[model samples]
Target: MRILAVLLMLTMLPVASAKEPYKAKPGVAGNITSVGSDTLGNLMTFWADRFKGHYPHVTFQIQASGSSTAPSALTEGTANVGPMSRELKESELNYFASTHGYEPTVLVVAIDAIALFADLHNPIEGLSLPQIDAIFSITRYCGGEQPLRFWHQLGLEGQWANKRIQLFGRNSVSGTYGLFKQKALCNGDFLPTVNEQPGSASVVQSVAYSDGALGYAGFGYKIAGVKTLPVSPGDGPYVKPSMVNIASGDYPLSRFLYLVVNKPPGQALPLLEQEFIRFILSEEGQKLVERDGFIPIPERLIRRQLNKIAGDV
Candidate 1:
């Protein structure tokens, strides 16, 4: 009887460990406000929901307008947290410095790739960065010396030959838009003919339905009817935006997603805010990142962010 009981206990150990939930240390209850990037909106909401399960008294006010608006919300004291898909502009940082006398804390939470998409029926297989620049920019830069207005310029044949390229992209307010302009367009202005959408989803939807449409958005927003185009840096061997490619730095458009906060000099973050950020950098939180279709920050980056947070505290 004793031997049988020992065997049974051993058999249940693995199951018990697998079913154990992540434990988060509780903190003071308060309302937490977040505003920023539409790209990080869904992921932030998921984090809030899970965090609330640990601290039931905590409430969240989240607004995902655009990354460009995050700086204003933080400076105005309307939001305590800012989620952004791109790095803060120098002007934004300077504004915070001028107001608070210090720089805000920036933490990288995940990785994303800006994917170029076209209607599934489009025969074009891929594009170089220069080609993309020419397609979207009014004043082409990099290696794209002339504007590519028609499909024939991109080597498409048959009915696509002379068809005018229908461009769709995020508006000026989007961080994704800014990043695309910087990396793909080489800081050139967008063409006047481009249709500016309000959100990533809108860009994907427009491209998926319009036969001649081409647009760019985060990899997570890819839809079924649209095909993602492989991209190269003005050369051959174009790479698709895949998990492995983005993680390995093979994807040209890959970028880090961030969480921003203003911490007073020589002071720690607010109790609730610190706890929330701790939870976000935890292994369980990174699991949520992977679940949401974004790449998790690697272990090394995670350790660096945690150490930075500790230093701030």
Candidate 2:
């Protein structure tokens, strides 16, 4: 009888109240809007869809005006974050310092290759840097450059003498155009009369549909009926732009994708953004990146990103 009484008294003690069940604080969810770089906007939309599976309450609005619009959107207070294909410019940095009182924080999200693709029917197999220089050079752009364009002209395999070379490319606003100009054009302007399509997909489509056509696009945008060319300088086996080659640094035209934020978002929204960025850097995320046809950043880059975030917070 005494033991039963002691147990009942202990259960009734004030300390017993400390073990109540956990009740979570209410979630303060809101929308976050981001815009920039059409080239990357498609990928970001895919990531946002996957993110929504975990966060049903949060809303993400994304748009792709161009890389040039990202910093302006951030400056105007319209977007919480911006996705970009290029680094911020000095003028953009100065504007941000004046308007937002701080420079935007730059975050790299992935590495991608810009590939030169041609109609599958074209006989020429590969291009050396010097040969490519000749092709893009205005002086040698004879109206007769076609299908084989001349094996001797390329110093490459399989020559047909009678075809005219057709060129397709992205509009001047595209980051792909900027990279292509820097890497392939050597700062020379694109050939006059070259067709300028609006997006990478269009460039792919045009090349796939036209005989004797050549174009450039993000490696991820490659499609059926077109052949990606292997490019190198001097004598080489040449290298195609693949995820492995890009991440491994064997592909020379690979470039980094970025997410630019003016300041760390506040507590509630920051958690979700942080989670999204974390997911992108995760094994699952990198796998998705490769599956979607872009290269994951190297492991060393991923670690460096995590460390930078840690330092920022």
Measured by lDDT, the strongest candidate is 1
For residues 65-112, write the lDDT of model 1, one tens digit per residue.
899999988988999999998888989999989998888888888888
Which runs of model 1 end up more than 4 angstroms from their true locations? 1-22
Task: Look at candidate 1 and give me any clashing residue pairs.
Answer: none
Best by TM-score: 1
Q: After superposition, how far is residue 4 of candidate 1 from its true place, in Å?
A: 57
Model 2 lDDT tens row, 1-313? 4321232233223331211221223352567688887778778887777766656777889988777778888888898778877667789889988886767777777778788888787777777655555565454332223323333455434444444667888777767777777666665566675788877888899989875777888888888899898877446778877766776556767677788776643322365565667767777666767777776665545655555555553
Cα TM-score per model = 0.90, 0.80
What Cα-based lDDT does every candidate model obtain? Answer: 0.84, 0.69
